[model samples]
Target: MSEPQTASAVEEERHASWPELFFDLVVVAGAGLLAHLIEDGDGWSSLFLFAVAFGAFWMIWTCFTAYGNVRGDDARLPTFLVGMAVLSVMVAAVPGIHEGHAQAFAIAYVVGRVAAARPWHGATVVVDLPVIQAFTGVLPWIVSFWVDGDAKYLWWAAGLTIDLLQLLRAREDKLLEGAQERLDHVAERRREQLAAHEERARRDGAEAPAMSARARRRQRRIDRLEKAGRVGRQIPTSIVALRTDNVHLAERFGLFTLILLGEGLIQMLNAASGAEWDRMLVVAWAGAFALIVALWNLAVRHGSAGVALLAHGAIPVRVQWVAHLVTSLALVAVAAVLGVVLAHPARTLEEHEVLVLAGALALYLLVSATVHAVLARRGGGVEDGRRAAWLAGAGVIAPAVVIVARESLSAAAVVCVLAAAALLVSVVDRRARLRLTGARDGRAVPASTP
Candidate 1:
């Protein structure tokens, strides 16, 4: 005979499990290797290399996330999928195999996603099946047959776009689920509070000996209204869950920034390997890489902190996810630019490329800082905004100065400027930390008081 269930047992089954962390190790290794390979390639080849590498990365991540969505609390399915994705990434990494082996890669990816969807069987499963079939079966077959570069790229973009949309839809579903749970909790709490109030009123009325039966009945009605009002006062738990999710997403942004920094360093090493190991080139390479890392840190620290704070308030999950996705994309683009700069510094900073690369980098920094500043301003205060604005202004101005002074300034001067920026940012970061600590400890003097 089956054991009798309790309320706690039902609740226990509803709580979601955290996704696997250690399983990402192999995927990370595969991506790093792919980045290395891309760094080794030239011109259009590099673009092709990046497309394949990033596609592979996204595929692996998407599959894992899909599995988590369907069988999050089940350890067996996720573990098996992660192992398979790791193997698929490694196989996709084979040089020259990207185009020819596209079918196999697609099959592996499709199987991973489809298998994960097994647990999600029902009405909604049908909606996802067609998209999966297009990505894994039809798109790959079509792209493989097309010998032309433009056609292949077009197909790849379309397929990847669909995959991204699916991911977004999944996130939306999670947001809705959290919202529903919060609403339910609020209603339940309100009902409990109303019940308590009604009980108190009923007791008071029954104890009054002079009260008529009609008066007692009126008191009962009043108690019911009070209970309803109490029930209505419950806090929406879904909003709270969304906020928590945002904070987690913000932290993910910080992690991605670190990944970009690593990419820059890898590119720098690749560049140095090609040139003479002279002191000047070494200094330039180190300075440039450090500057990139500093810029990344500046973007994420302020941005993520702001996101974390705003997430504590009642913001919509959709808005938060949009902001997070944009920031993540910008970070990736910046990293790609830095990789190009490091890999082909001479070619990159040349007359034709300099204008575009420098401008793009400046624009990205400005936008990133602005978004973070806006979020920060809305949450805690304007301090983060001031800091972000200053950094952005420097990012814009320094590139211009570098471009104009290219002839007049020595390589040492360029290196010096980059080094100075990094140092200045580090110092400012430390000061901010100290000030925050002082305030937390009650050791800080208020501006008005001082």
Candidate 2:
């Protein structure tokens, strides 16, 4: 007789809750502040500040998110909220980071981190370098009030680099440890689990049993995921181990991306708040808004954006991380640029500003193309092929966008160029779908359904 899998199934399949959603919204506010900094501070300096601040926010968010993904029970929910509250306070102080709120920011960051460190079952956080990195990242902010000028940012940058290098290198070591070694680790874990179960059975005056069917099923899944190679796609190796329910991880990622897109749209609205409603501004506004919306469809709404991460056992976990990171940062930058462009529709952009916008759009295209390429290589059905080609065409046109925004033309011209590019990509996208419908089997589905 099959045992009814009720409570465990309910807990495991639980989606993110209202509290977590609120926490993410708070962090989105922080992202907006970071982008706004670029408008205030001198160009490169502001950009540097955004990088350092964004890096810190991203690290904290990523840690908490991972914890959320694999956390054992709902009992820790309140404790997690305490951590998020402290994080909210820290985010509020970010605007004053270069000024007087150093002490407040430092203390809040430490408290939030301590709360985030609450133990997870079986998983040890004792030597986690990423946590150490997050703490180290706060050090510069602590003494930021004393250190004057760009040298301060240098310290933050140096500390961040050290922490990142360690994480990357450690992940690389695990990847190179090879499939046999990974399988061995899985077996060892299984043994420990079964041995404990046997002890319990004996204590109850019964015969000790072998690994249960559920445990066996989990191990088999891990084996399949671990043995999943990067041969079909260009993803060489996995830096993270993703097994069991991948929707858990993918859902978290999708939430974060939605936040980034929201940040862009929010900035755009803030930029156009009370400005005059002339014909040119209206056209430029619509175009910039469409650009943002089109981007969402390209990756989030449509199947093209699907990393097919969990489905394609052939790809590595790190690819998903990298892809998500690229998507977040690119969308953030696009939002910031669009806001600036919308602000001065008829006026020629400062030479530096024009250059920045051009570079940002190009970066967006490059990252988009990369995401699509991975999906296509993974055999992500018709949408993948169609979207990949569309991305290629948009990339080709991106440069021409900058050229059109010559010194003689208004900065608004850049908006026009990007809009045109967006439309062109849409056309390609439609063509891709129509051109490759039901192209038969042996193809990997592009995660079309939720």
Candidate 3:
């Protein structure tokens, strides 16, 4: 159940607002901290903890995101802002999370999530599955505080496993009931409009469309029943409902991605500022920029297009949002890689650094490809080999580079390879677009102008 909608809440903006921007900044700050966490801890253990920790935080964010999707920016706007602020505090404590400050961090984490889970609108919104699932999952993190050492993380493992299993157990029909609330909301609006129009007609003595004799009798009976307070029913709905503004959801998700991309550039420049004026450093910096640009194109440009596909009814919102989540995690991993490379441009990365890049790109490529495939299958757009090859190639690039490149040459070598791959993807995408447009050779508008 949702609360009554306010006029201000109903009129949404075309893009993420200032509050949304602030929320994303906090989320990205936490993601950046996770990279540092991985760097500071024991190789595999810290990485595992990072994954678990990230999942917990991301799950909470996603909970709020879904809630906002249903309620829009009006009602829950303040709640979302306050929740992210608390969540930022929770994420800030991630470094000492398993150690001295574990209790403080856990409390912040729980409070933040609980804050985000509360109702956003004046309407009586029944706390739904997204929040319920997140709170249930947070129990393990909370309980972990009572225990000592590695066993705490084990509890985390158990909690998330249960949370995920429960999510899996959710009814597909209800889970996919995607647009019922939105549909009902729309129906309510239409009803209001009809009533208003009818009132205007009566006041102005303007004739409305003529009703059949049976229709007139039905209307009279309905009016009488309403006066007698006996009319009661809910709106009828079907299974294929999608009530969300797909563009708005996509736009919000894209803004969040942009937040990370901005951070990557800021961090990279900050790291490069003090480095030696050597040839390798300059080349590495360039490579880093190219990599970021390439990633931006992959994650944001096409990502918005996928949202457009959903908005246009070419694909399911569920699949697109899932793609956004996986792709977002992968983008965070890319940010982690950028942090590593930028921090030590001249030095060769360790095996773990290489693996991080590999894993992130693997997921990014796979998810990007999958979303593109989904759009392509729906005939939303034509598939190009240039984009396809790069999408398929990134996953395969990292491990091979890490293994074969020598220590002194590895860092620059990896950067160059990735830069080339990204550049080639653009070249391929450009040429294919030109051919499609029947342009023999004048400059074409670049794909994903950002």
The 0-to-1 C-alpha lDDT of every candidate, in the order given, reads 0.49, 0.58, 0.61
Query: Whole-model lDDT, candidate 1?
Result: 0.49
For candidate 3, report its TM-score: 0.71
Clashes of 1: 4
Clashing pairs in 3: 3-123, 3-124, 4-123
Ranking by TM-score: 3, 2, 1
Write candidate 1's Cα lDDT for 1-450 as tens digits.
Answer: 111111111122232233444444444454455554444444555555455545645454534443443333554655555555655654554454445654454455545555544543221222211233223433553554444444554555566666556544655345345435545665576667666656766666677666556556756675566564433343322222111233333444455445655655665676667766566665667667667656555555544522321222234433443444444343444444444454444432444234333443565556555654775677735666756665576567876876786666544445446546545655665576677777989897444331
What are the per-residue Cα lDDT tens digits for candidate 2 across 1-450? 111111121234567766566667767777787676666665777777777666666666766665655543453667657757776876787788778664565566556555666543212221223343235545555565467666766766665565465454545333334433544455466556555654554454433345355555655554454466311222222223222234565666667767777877876787778566787688778878777776666556552223311233224444555455545666666677677777767877775566556656666676666666776787776566656666666766765556664677765667777767866776556554543453454454453511
Regions of model 3 farther than 4 Å from truth: 1-13, 120-135, 161-169, 175-243, 305-315, 373-389, 406-408, 439-450
Question: Model 3: per-residue lDDT, tens digit, 9-116?
Answer: 234546665665666667767767866666666488877777767766766676666556655646456777776877777687787786566566667667766776
TM-score of each: 0.56, 0.69, 0.71
Segments in model 2 whose C-alpha atoms lie over 4 Å from true places: 1-14, 72-75, 102-114, 121-148, 172-245, 303-315, 374-389, 441-450
lDDT of 2 at 70: 51
Candidate 1 ranges beyond 4 A from true positions? 1-21, 33-56, 62-73, 77-87, 90-109, 119-148, 162-257, 270-275, 292-296, 299-348, 351-364, 373-380, 403-426, 429-450
